[model samples]
Target: MRIFALPLVVLASFVASAAAEYSCAGPDARTQPPTGAIVVDPTGAYSGSFHNLSEAVSNVPNTTDEHTIFLFPGVYREQVLISRLNGPLVLQGYTCNTKLYAANEVTISHAKAQRDISPEITSGRNDLTSTLRLKTNDVKVYNLNVANTAGRFLENGQAVATIIEGNNYGFYACNFTSHQDTVYANKGRELFA
Candidate 1:
């Protein structure tokens, strides 16, 4: 009998790829939003101020205004970098159960590898390669699905789903899925439920 061992990194990548292959068989079931919740619909069918998630995040003033962003059912493909938020911020996703991440219908994803960086940029950390990077304090994310679609067959380096680099941040009922570096809580006080 012959036995061959695979590296842990390779094994992890295989598992991630296997999970990625699994998809929803049909269209996502619709659910009514919470009363008075701001809605963001990609189809322009809803009364939303912005169509894209980045625009919604950008519309918010940098001051401590304390705002909440409600994302409707959709697969948003973009790299979202939130920085210098002096006040409280809440990003909510459409879900049947607010306390359970399994019912989340919103997915924010992006495909970016570490090797695609330019030479001018130094300190090429995984934060720069994240799909969603939050650099503000007092941030709360609820019932949201954040993913990095960079795939698991990369030649080098890692991809991240969410980079938490702020103080007093809380993530509740959120599903974070990625091949590598799914959730990087590097600094400050944070809570994940």
Candidate 2:
């Protein structure tokens, strides 16, 4: 019995390519922004002017539909505040390895602490230094890093990397770094996957 080998070879090559792209699937997945997501890129590589996390988070419309904000590779030096959303929100960072936090390329950082915050903050002093504050529920964050650049207990105090005040929050392959008080999820059911 003579079996044609060309079909088998082509199938093998197709499977090999698909397996190799498992880490970063989808067309132009590593280079293009995700569809239906608000893109944030500091280099102005995206179509919109949502160059900063602060700008993108604030502009999210209050709707019942699921929304997502995609961040490109960069260190965004600003505070990110996610207000109460009527629906679910997703904050995703561009990463080659979506399952590893160490490979995250998007970082939201701020060099401030409780002492640096003004009296205008009404969420109590504990939240004054948080670089990223999520006040809404049903949020998913992936492959992102948040850092409070305040010095350790010596010169700075209570520099929080993130503060989540909402329920049903999922943070996957994300890193929160700071000198003190890295993350505060006092009033929420959070999952760190």
Candidate 3:
């Protein structure tokens, strides 16, 4: 009888993967807002914090410096549009467990549909029906919940949780809650986990 030997690389790869722990924001979630970041705290617990996410996003300078936005615990009712920025953007939400999206303390919600055209949108657009719209590249969002409350209706049509028209987007430990079309992305590089 002949004995066959397995490759050493195969065994090493198995051991490395077995020891690896799956986590979006590492093992522990963020408790404190990062320095120099625009913080959004609707509860007013943090001094100088913006009351809403839209205001905080607008406050970001259009410079090629790395920027981060930390969100405190609260439900924010707004339609946010993150446009082109010169720098990389990071949106981090407060969470006790970074491993789970359900542990997120911050949620951005809006009830809108393509059928409902506004002044900004003269015609019905699939992208406009999204609760959160990202049109820029090099963006990473973590531990946040985005929801579209628009349900099944003949007039309401399909509702989207998020629309990513940007080139590069990475969403980690995030929850996109919607009955129809949870996410719609253009022809770009995107990742969701």
Candidate 4:
């Protein structure tokens, strides 16, 4: 019994240490933009334009500090996940209504049916989760519309437009449009729209 207990205690300690090492602190905040102008077009490369939002976010100097990504006016049809590990990130759209259209779409009846059913049934629904999942703090998105337009399918439940799980996150002049769970503001305390 003593030998078994010793091994269990050691395993528990190791697990705790590993969990503690994982942190959500973002890189040093920057007061200025990292690049002159970062454009994201479906038909361009690194010259200044990016083919996707993730590429633009990936090009940001993760180790150098905070930075900004200026996205040109276009309908970005992809799920954007902003991680907190990459320093302070600012996604600025060229136009006031630059839309980030999530591929997932949810209708009114579909949303109602899911709510009436078991939560587990809805848990398997990725479209109902969020089109944009934010895992970073101090991140701001300006003049953009994040949405999940994937209507009911046999595969899942409802669709979520945006999921905010970061602290001190701000959405300025941005629209989060969806049916149910339009914005899942979870865990993190500080959030502003």
Best-to-worst order by TM-score is 2, 3, 1, 4
Tens digit per residue, CA lDDT, model 4, 1-193: 9999999999999998876544222242122234664556665643657777777766766664557776554567777767765567677655412232221111111122243346666343443356777788777776666766655534444567777777777676566666656777775765454
Query: How much is the lDDT of residue 22 in candidate 4?
Result: 40
List candidate 1 segments past 4 Å from native: 1-38
lDDT score, residue 109, model 2?
92
Rank candidates by lDDT, best first: 3, 2, 1, 4
Give one digit per residue, the lDDT tens place, for model 3 in 1-193.
1232455667777877755543325558587898998999998889999999999999998899989999999999998999889999999999977778978989999998766756586653768888899988899999999999887746677788898988878899999988778888865899888
Can you tell me which runs of candidate 4 are displaced by over 4 Å?
1-37, 96-128, 152-156
- Candidates 1 and 2, the one with greater lDDT: 2
Q: List candidate 2 stretches off by more than 4 Å.
A: 1-31, 118-123
What pairs collide in candidate 4? 84-136, 104-148, 104-149, 104-150, 105-149, 105-150, 105-151, 127-159, 128-158, 128-159
Clashes of each: 0, 0, 0, 10
Alpha-carbon deviation at 97 in model 1, angstroms: 1.1
Q: Judged by lDDT, which candidate is best?
A: 3
TM-score against truth, every candidate: 0.77, 0.81, 0.81, 0.60
- lDDT tens per residue, model 2, 20-117: 86546554244456678888989896778588988888888888999888899999998878889999998888887777788688999988877786
- Our tally of clashes for model 2 stands at 0
- Model 1 Cα lDDT, one tens digit per residue, 1-193: 1233457667888998876544333234235545544567788887654687898888777666687788888899999988887679888887766656887889999887676666577784688889899988899888789998777736745788999888998888888888877888999999989
Point out the worst 10-residue segment of candidate 1 by lDDT: 21-30
Candidate 4 clash total?
10
The global Cα lDDT (0 to 1) of model 3 is 0.86
